[model samples]
Target: MTISPDVAAVSTSRSQRARHYVMTRPTFFTVAYAINPWMDTTTPVDVERAVAQWETLRATYSTLGHTVDLVDPVPGLPDMVYAANAGLIINGTAIVARFKHAERDGESVAYATWMDRRGHAPVSTFHVNEGQGDLLVVGSMILAGTGFRTDPRAHAEVAALTGMPVISLELVDPRFYHLDTALAVLDDTTIAYYPPAFTDRARAQLQQLFPDAIEVSSTDAYVLGLNAVSDGKHVVHPAQATGFAEQLYHAGFHPIGVDLSELLKGGGSVKCCTLEVFS
Candidate 1:
């Protein structure tokens, strides 16, 4: 797909970085309960298809020169496969999630145990937080989300733990419950987002922070197009988000698409299934 002239003009070369990521195989992935809008208890999940798609995503990261670590899936915790929600790992320190919903509460401990085994200092939080789901690292700061899963009070806690400035962005739409679901960090200072997902104040903050950020179409946003992982250059995202992929390509990014349709039934995609381990 070709991009508009204005978009092409803004295209510039970006540096690529090799990253480390943690993932969990969908050994017990199923939608037996509904927490997010995309999830429905009545929906039948194809476990085999979900596993295959997750495998493809893992393989894609390996091909892109990134390291992949595995956290063993816990039985009966189906949503454990969405590893990003487990915790936010920054420079070898883990701030484990305090899940808001009881159904996913067990996943936090499972991930914390894995982090501890890996020599990461896992620290617990007092306020409710959903790890990378509500927290995104942008340049030298963290963009934190609230109004859905994470509590607003958790923002200051993350700032104190990481010693990084935290910018709280409130999510307004149920469909875009997490900051990662609505915004994809394209590079250290660049981002692509669905503006309507955030409140007016949050949108204003984003505009001031990233004036040239890509505004995604509503059609692509509904497909969770912004829920992507990027190592500065290559952006791994849902295969169905063709339009967003094109935008990434024109913006001088290598967009790699993978089919995670089965996992999407559980309200997660590429970024949700993968957690970046910064060191």
Candidate 2:
């Protein structure tokens, strides 16, 4: 069939738009339940509010033109809501975590099952690792956390699994148990972090690696500001992190804050609830 010049131009325009949409869309994983801290069982959780906040986060991602996926939340396992702790995804392969604490050990199997069902080859880890909670992908390198929830030996396991270079950064403070609690990757070369969370050596490594990283304030870090997610453009952070949001805006990023205070009682906020699904 011979098409007219105008018709061909319109067809080309549609094809270009289709490609743009496919290229820009991002995929993420989430869970329905709120992960309450085992140490603080008495801490009250408004299940209704937590669910509403999670739904809002999902809606926000959907509105921003992204794919949001889910994993079933087990009744007894409260920490399952922090889906990022389940596994690390690289090149669409899942390296499922082996939890150090028995309380969250069952989560590994649940996430592994989901990964298998989702068409990703799920590989179980022999060493203790808390998935993305302790692993942050920056550029071509993986910044892994140690001296806290995740074990140092897991770095080698991750490197072996993904065939990517892993840099082990030790965490010192108990408050920032996971790497996600104190750091966020804004882009390939840039990151936002709270210095106090890392040990002296880890802080130096971060400075050397990311010279232009934004240093978040203690006040903001206390509210889990660094536990934010960015699409190399817009950043989703805690609503009360206004100062950090301004800094993000100055750094050529659009910051969107969604309140997750109810979930904070469980020692998590935004990033913990969202897991990146590698394509």
Candidate 3:
């Protein structure tokens, strides 16, 4: 595949931009119920370790010259720690998530309250949408995932709200329920993804859109390595995803590994716990 000049420039220069992020402390993190394949209710959780790991992720963001904001954790909402599902904040508008499952439905209100208090114009949608979990911003387009968590109808809502062209991608694997789980946006033009997780049409779309994108191995994809947060230059991903880390380095981007294994039991990692707030 011929790499575009813009993508080549991004690889060569490795330019970075400061980001504003919202993170929730894993104060109530645990696997009490099974919502995804990574969650096993029978497996015991280490709450203390989860909190420590979350703190480290937060500190890492601060160390990277990015601003970090915190939202108070709700007691019964264990999955609230995955703050990225709360809402999609972009272009000065916050489209709060309406979760598909009842288990996480309450999170929408909590996140909306936080966004409202912070002066972000919070908009509510009747359709089911898991915020950044299913919607990822890539340059001027929004890549939306469906067939698992978020509803296809929400794709139109996102386009209407943000005024950005949305490309709908169908997720076939149960494990990679969210778009973030199977794909990571490395920068405005670059992406890293696992092809098997998507439908044939979605895979074709990705290949057409990002010809120079990195195709990660299943080994790294299972570890939620594609659930990474990138700041144009630096990619923050799971420590267990060693192969993905090496790929990022070879692609001319710096990859920082962070251990969020404790939270991984709940089926989330770096990007899952972190939500980028575009003001």
Candidate 4:
């Protein structure tokens, strides 16, 4: 029996794509403006602290031996510090985002320009989507978040572009606006999630898909424990999520903690700042 050329091509591409993460330096990072429920105009952000935290995360990825690519941060776009919202990239194809809010809409152009220069096929989105901040890839499936930052229409667009099935999950908690904040894809078969962040139906869907997933506690969730980044081995997460870190250790995973208190003011942490750029 022989496989068709199209089938063989897809198999080869999926097998060969290199794994990498994209980051934008928090050069002018701040929460001076409010867009989401997380940001408050009265709340002050420590720019120096945010940059240091971001640098640590970048170095953590470098120390883990994953390629850390940098995208130029545009002035006046303070939220660009959260690079994961830029777009979703898989097999060198980028599905550029169309932000639900005007505040972040300009980000799509910047990310598209970067993708073009990097030689990736850039596909612009029509419906509102906040990029990987609401889209997570696990093994061969995509877990997409909606009911807040991303629109359901964008999920279909993503599936069409990547040629993979997308499981749409509705977010219920405003604080965990993006799926990346409410859930973390630890490995091909494991995930860490906060139950309260998702609606009942969406929570059930996750339970069906990842029955043995690590259920994060409310305390951990408060500190953004679910917003973690893992390379199938080492997990980088917020230091404040102490209990979750211990849980990761007992579960046979190495968890490294970093303080991102400053950025937390803007409702983002480790995963928010890191975007996986699938080769």
Off by over 4 Å in 1: 1-12
Steric clash pairs (candidate 3): none
Better of 1 and 2 by TM-score: 1
lDDT of 3: 0.93
The lDDT ranking, best first, is 3, 1, 4, 2
Residue pairs with backbone atoms closer than 3 Å in model 2 (clashes): 35-78
Model 2, runs deviating above 4 Å: 1-39
Q: Which ten residues in a row have the lowest lDDT in candidate 1?
A: 4-13
Over the stretch 1-279, how does candidate 4's per-residue lDDT look in tens digits? Answer: 355576455334322223598999988787777777778888877798888988898888888788988999998888888889988989767888888878776778888898899887688878888888999999999999998889899889899888999999999888888999889988888899999899999999999999999999999998888889888767899999999997776565678998988998888999999889875
Q: Over the stretch 162-185, how does candidate 1's per-residue lDDT look in tens digits?
A: 999999999999999998999999
**Cα lDDT for residue 137, model 2?**
87
Cα error, candidate 3, residue 8 (Å): 12
**Alpha-carbon TM-score of each model against the true structure:** 0.96, 0.86, 0.96, 0.92
Better structure of 2 and 4 per TM-score: 4
Model 2 over residues 49-100: C-alpha lDDT tens digits?
8877877777777777777777777756777778888888778668888998
Worst 10-residue lDDT window for candidate 3 reads 1-10
Clashing residue pairs for model 4: none
Worst 10 residues of 2 by lDDT: 16-25
